[model samples]
Target: MCGIIGYVGADGALPIVATGLKNLEYRGYDSAGIALNNGTVDVFKQSGEIDDLTLPAEHSATCGIGHTRWSTHGQPTDANAHPHTDESGDVAVVHNGIIDNYESLKSELSSHTFTSETDTEVIPHLVEEHLSDGDDLLSAVEATIERLEGSFAIAVTTSGQDGFVVARQDSPLVLGHGEDGNFVASDVTAFLEHTREVSYLEDGDVALVTGADVTVYHDGGTVDRPVQTVDWEADAAEKGGYDHYMLKEIHEQPQALRQTLSGRLDTVTGDVDLELDLPEQYLNSLEEIQVVACGTSNHAGQYAARLLEQFADVRTTVEVASEYEFRGGRDPWRTLVVAVTQSGETADTLSAMRRAASAGARTLAVTNVVGSTAAREADDVVYIRAGPEIGVAATKTFAAQVATLTMLTVYVGRQRGALSGDRASTLLENLRRLPGAIQQVLDEEDATREVAYDLIDSDGFFFVGRHLGWPVAMEGALKLKEISYINAEGFAAGELKHGTLALVTEDTPVLAVLTDGAKPDQTLNNVKEVESRGAPVIGVSSLDDTTKYLDVEFAVPDLGTLEPLVANVFLQLFAYHVADALGRSIDKPRNLAKSVTVE
Candidate 1:
């Protein structure tokens, strides 16, 4: 939702901090600011895009921190932009996440003069009140983190101190070590130009950086964290002539899917091996299953639930993560809980998994992140191997989740003797063909992107499908709304007449996933319902005979059963392109965060 960068070096700090913030512009922000540690703390803030703010020549310093914020608690304004200062204007803070208890903190600090309408302002003052006479910067930070509530990745500088004190909880922060000094940023890209080596700070960790050394602490004790060497070239974060990251990501899908499936699916074994070393009997004995997630991952869970029920014969239920903990507490035991999260730190999903685990049910986490809390806490973990998905509206991760879950379905089904050897092998072969099928769809980007362009001026989108494809339609609507900011709804093809058909008008565009592998005639009948209303229909399917109802046909690969899953990747690109064309922020749409780490 926000980007943070901090640097301490022999060179001046504003240029280094600004360059870091510029590199992180793809994350999306409503405003930008920086705090420089000259003799006294100097802060400059602006209420617009990072590029819109001009760097001042007089702001000279050797240490500094910068921020690009997506507003959550307050409206975007110059005063509300970060690098917020203490009431006395001695300490300054740049924060990348929500401060959940800010209201209480704000009321408590009402006796002191306040300047900005921001939760972030509470941070500087909290530090102001807590920094002891003899305490070091790290101790002050640790003390502040304990007092605060909700997620945050904060970098602070004080007039009394010489270096920056950085802390992270729920929000992400990393330390970048360089030749002349040390740095901190929300993600590795913030300092990629200067250093590829980065140490990801876990929740409740604090880092204190001097010009020559970087030290980290956790729970009031000093600790050494491992540095994760990023595989991507620095240029991967830069747009290689592409207009936007969303566009680049759309084009990168073919390679992305190949990367995701590389070593995960083994054809010779006739099993989609996650290699997760769980008891086969444990999976075979599952009487019921619950799929928990939010946003795009939730849509993937919908499809996964169907696949689990169909292949493994496990009764499956899909629930939105925030509601799942309360709703699922009433479900019986012996039920396997599967939590899907691309980042793994999704707050609601994590909470739901914890509640389920505490209730004595075996829990599994399906995600792309390797060390995310979901991976750390789950009884078993299946990494999608999608590799650093930066775009906020998920592309490869969605496809990878579907592919990984499909394999898990087959694995569980095989364990329970639910499917014959020939059937399982055939399904695995179809699964292996998905990456190429998606590549075929990727080649047709011009056609799909054109449809997105035509719908850019429209206010609403309707996606309709049936059976397994029904969830795909809902996911398509979600992707469109997530990035494009359009009003989108998905309905079962047959259920459109039940109430939703009235929303379909000639000006509205209706996307129909007509590739009803299981219910072809019913899907066609559903398409006819929207077409009769004169709504423009974009049919996404592998079937060749869709000439009757479709205004524009987005043809997918002929992988048969696997096409329903692969078709989702194409819809995501369509949504992304539409949003990009509308000049919407595709990566961090207003009021949305990539990881909803707080409720």
Candidate 2:
């Protein structure tokens, strides 16, 4: 993963690119660099945080491109930092993804000298060759892209060129139109502070930015891309009153879930009108459902897998997107592949969805981003509608994803004659109650904070659950370890004694999801097992009279099968408070990116 920020305006370049780099640092912070064109191109870069990259206090240049990298090709170093330039340093480039044919391209360009071991260096040299042949900046970059093979979002600026050229194939790039400037970045947040009027560039799209204006080209012809104002304001990206974006997002879950459920659910008739393109014939013949995702998305897929199987009676399986194989003796035409990604640029998820698509499986993208690659390429898309999640550690998006997939499940089940009207009605009713249930949990944050403070010194944490609660437990552990950096693991309640019991100690706190639908009675046995070893048990329970068993109990309001998902808010608050207590970088944890754009 990497970040790209490019600007062409009347103002100085250094401050614009520098501030943009800091704003997008969460995307990639390993190494940072900026290439400015002030009659002559000058590059400033370092293999450290954005703050470590020294730059001129003031620059007269009106255009520049910057990059923050999360090392894909070369290791993070000053030489490996981007804005990789040509021999004369006249042509500079900043890229967000990998160059698949760099070795071959590097061998071909034997006359040119390379300073870094990065694949991105090939581009500037290729552009330099094109420019030396009397090609213009846009033509040079277009020619350079012809020789390049792989997923990349590139921004190139030349000393002699009045503007910069940008192109994207697989990685994301957004164009922002501001009052006095035009911007190019990997995401909206990179330039959200300057402008909300933006347009998403699709695959094979290229653009040139010059002095408050942008011209886009696709398929060798000029294209007029529609520019729309973003829904959320610049200040929404800020932490607001919270200590970290993670905490703010954790508390924003109720509103986020409501947004997901809004205008989609019909509680009376149990009908879910997502208005998808999937036909009744297709839904009737859909024999298998494959959910493809990575990391937290994979956990959400796991949760959705259970729901799909139960609701639609479909043979459903969850696969970590990278490891997904499309051909497995299954009838592709009868299979439905669901790609779940919060940021639709996850390379592995896109690759997996592509494989499934090429095999003839109808693919659906369930994502929060509106114009993301997944949304653009999928056969159909269901928006999660959780607007503007800025936390590197996902909170509201996870709940929103689960809710959206549940609605999809209901829709499919109704179409396939798997779910009765009463059954769907019941599920919809419970789904509608989700936000209120989570709010009840959010109200108990003070108690959850106390639990976090008490367990702050623990050696490790164990999250255990069963049934629908399984993925919730896994997600709970993921949140704690991601932000707090605690040694946390989640397991099926029945599996704790298989081999995990040996690791339990008095210093370890067991977080048991003993809710109404999680098979609480069986999980209580594991709770007793951990309690026998003197481990403190923090139970998320709906069952009454569990006071004697749990060391710290967070009562979950009953929402039937959805109660386990409700318990997740407490876990999020617990992780936030623990990370806060340890003075951790909860928003941007070390060595983690919000979007993984490289496979």
Candidate 3:
């Protein structure tokens, strides 16, 4: 995935576009570049982080486009950086996503010269060819897009043209309607400081933007797009007072949970109402529930799958979206497919949802973004309301996703008459107290930090649990590996002795999640298996007796099935403190991006 930002305004475009690139850099950071247009187009780029890029002082252009690239077509180098241009250097372009048919297009345009080893370089040449044939800038862009065969969000500017043309297909692009100017970017955060009002572009929509206006077109006809105001303040993207974005986001979990639960749950009646627009009959008709997600979101889906089966009595299955196959002769009718993604733009999950739709299954998207492609394309949507998560490793969004999915479980259970009113009320009361319970865990961070210190020098880590705790274990291991750069593995506690126990040693610490419903005795036995092998045991549980067997213990709130959710917070804190102690890049770990928009 790459980040793209374009601006047309009275203010100098270089500074604005560069600032926008900095804000959107979480999406990509391999290399950075920009194209400015005054009387001529000037392109500046380098093969490093955006902060390392240097710009010339004399190019006083009022309009430009910038890009922060996560290399896909070629290696990360100055020659492969973006803001690619044509032979005459008249047309400059920045592109996100891939151009699948670039090779064929390049073969067809043999007369044109190419400089960079990127699929994006073909775009500017194609646009220049169309312009030479007397096509307007918009028509040239449209013609060039028609020849491309993969997902792309592209912005192009010509030397003589006073404005830019942008188009999107199966990729994200948003237009900002500002009073002083107009802007376009891959994410709203790019221009959020300058404008809160934005319009989302649909697949195959092309927009022509100038300093004062933006005109959108689809299929050769003018189209009107609705503009929505964003509620996130610019400061929300910044690390308020925390040492890192991950730590700040970890501390913001309470507020994030509050936002997710506000107005959706009725405390008195214990009724769950979501923003989903589906009818009650549609919800009740579900014969099975299938959840598709990836990484941490997939773990959240696993937790929800358990709730759906236990509370709603529904036959639920959780599948990794990238591996989900729809052509395996499964019935589509009476089946509901729920796609959970924090960014709402994950490539594999989106592709899986499209397959589900093609298979005639009713689809619902649970996501954090209001206008993300998944939310727009799914039959129904439930917003996570987690706000902007800047860290590459997910913290608050994971908690919010689990809470929202729990609410969804309750909603479906109530609709299907599987949960009695009294039981539902009891569950709702516990759910309401989750925010405070999570805060209690945050208040006891010192204990987690001390555990982190003890394990900071460990060669590796082994996280093991059962049932819902299984997914929690997977999430914990993921956090440690992602942020702390530790060699970590997660397994069902029962599976440990079967194979993974062979890797256990005194220097390898085993972290056990001993929570209710996770078969504590069996897990403790597994812990003792490792302890007998001389491995240190770090236990996370509500039972004080666990302290007898554990070398170190981190206590968690005893909330039944909810215990795993709260215990996860302790793991997150441990990961953060360990990474902090190791001096690792907790927020932007190497070779990782915040969102995976490409397959």
Candidate 4:
């Protein structure tokens, strides 16, 4: 979850490096820096946004590397920012992702004074120290990789070397070659001004980039890195035709889910391909299944667990990633571990994958980022196919995850012979209709937007539901708090009386969900309890149910197999609309950052 940029061209390198870092600013904004060779290596770094940075007027060099950091190893500060240099100041490094074993390495480094809290600082120092011991720049980088643990996509530069040295383990890094020179970045955006043709680096791969050539290696041997064409325009990554990236992303959900469900669903076979190529014995032998995720993804996991257990007849547990590994109840080896993450950079989920791997379990990842840490680390990975969701609130990615997991449920059920042909057909049909159902709710945005306004001004908001909608309610509350910076709570409707009811007060908004048809009466009962205590009630129910016992009512498409997902999207829109009305920073909310790379 950071950005890296490197360049080698006849043009003066500092300005290109600075501009590239600015383009990567959206990915990270905490700190910015660059290292360029102007006879001697010149490094400039500062805390805060790149716009506020002041670099030397000129660094006369044709090769450079830069970084924009979202702090994980240290707090956002100048002392801990990147472009970290070695003791001799001859070698400098810029990095994205984490170095998990840095603490041990830091303790072992008695020869250098560590100036930064960043794990990235360890690289330049290690490379320089290794070079001091007589290894060339490429050999030193290779040696350092052997001693390092955890995810990293690093670019190292030295005044003496004629090229940029790059290495990757679990993080993303790409190289773009141009007639002028060669380039590197965490994504295509940083170098789109130069080229559209790029090469992707796989785990344990290294590349050496110079003005005339680009060579790749694995371990210590030469390797050919496959070059891929990036079809997305530079402006597609921009806020095209929308005021905010959040709104555009929300609007993109329909196509995103469709693409996610397309090839994976097999209508004739009534199964999902998953693309995992999981062994038949392993697929059939699973005694239990576990899904680990964080934030909105956890809600998707909850629904998947319930669906898999009910429809597939597999015992399933959905656990929050932040707390999953420490929970003492589950045997990891006997379970199929499925880790869900949108960025694929979530630290907790990655750690949980390691825990599951250590316990000898089969591991799978469902993620949106191709070649992400979670994707590359897991034993098997499912791509959600939701391209580039930039909004920190995560609308399209969440919906896409749910759709893919739904197909996975049916796939596992069909594989295990637990799902009857008729039942599988019904579920697949419903899955196909989900996009339309969601679109119907989106068409009624005016009603939900008004509801959002009413709740935005309230003192406090509470969301409650029974059964499956409980997770939806939690997600609704999370969306509100995440973007609007409001105080909100989501509780199981049945648990309202157990001390949570005390928080209900006049002017407090309570959103109650009744998608569980059988529990409408019970859900209404819970609403009555809150209404009796003077809380304002807003009911989200089926479009067919015209009757309203609450102060406000929001209708949603009522399809089986978690119909609330459609309803939940409407709630997500509500939260976003309300946050917008309040003049809140809908994309980058205060005190929050996207992709928690640290615990």
Better of 3 and 4 by TM-score: 3
List clash counts for every candidate, in order: 0, 0, 0, 0
Error of 2 at 432 (Å): 1.0
Better of 1 and 3 by TM-score: 3
Expressed as tens digits, the lDDT of each residue in 1-599 for candidate 4 is 67899998777788888989988887677788888886578888898889877788876798999988766556568877788999878898988766767878998886689888777888888898889899888889999999887668899989788878999876678889787889998878787877888988999988888888998999678998878777666755345335578887777677566656654555665766665676667767778898999999998898788789888888888888978763456565558999999888999999988888888788999987655788778888887766566788888888889888988888788878899878887788777788788888788888888878866778878988876778888989999999988888986898989988888898688888877522555777888898888888888887455254578777767677557787788778888888989999988888777789998
Q: If scored against the real structure, what TM-score would every candidate get?
A: 0.62, 0.63, 0.62, 0.61
Candidate 1 Cα misplacement greater than 4 A, ranges:
1-237, 326-333, 516-518
Would you list the clashing residue pairs of candidate 3?
none
- Candidate that beats the other on TM-score, 2 or 4, i.e. the better one: 2
Q: Please give the lDDT score at residue 335 for candidate 3.
A: 86
Candidate 1 residues 1-599, lDDT tens each?
Answer: 57889998898898999999988775545689888997588888898889987678756689999998765445567888888988877788988766667778889978777788777888887788777455556666677888787667899888867789999876678898888888998777788888877788888888889888888987668999998666666656454336566666666565555544554454665666565776767766777888999988998898888878877788899999988863444444558899999988999999999988988888999987655689889998887755456667777778878888888888888787886667777778887787677778777778878888877888698887887788888988888988888899876788888888888898888887866452656787878888898998888877768778889888767665667777776788788888878888876778877788997
The models' CA-based lDDT, in order, is 0.79, 0.87, 0.87, 0.81
lDDT of 3 by residue, 372-483 (tens): 7898899988987665688999999999999999999888988888988887887777778888989999999998898899779999999999998899999999999999
Look at candidate 1 and give me any clashing residue pairs.
Answer: none
Rank list by lDDT: 2, 3, 4, 1
In candidate 2, list every pair of residues with a backbone clash: none
Off by over 4 Å in 2: 1-237
* Residue pairs in candidate 4 whose N, alpha carbon or C atoms collide under 3 angstroms: none
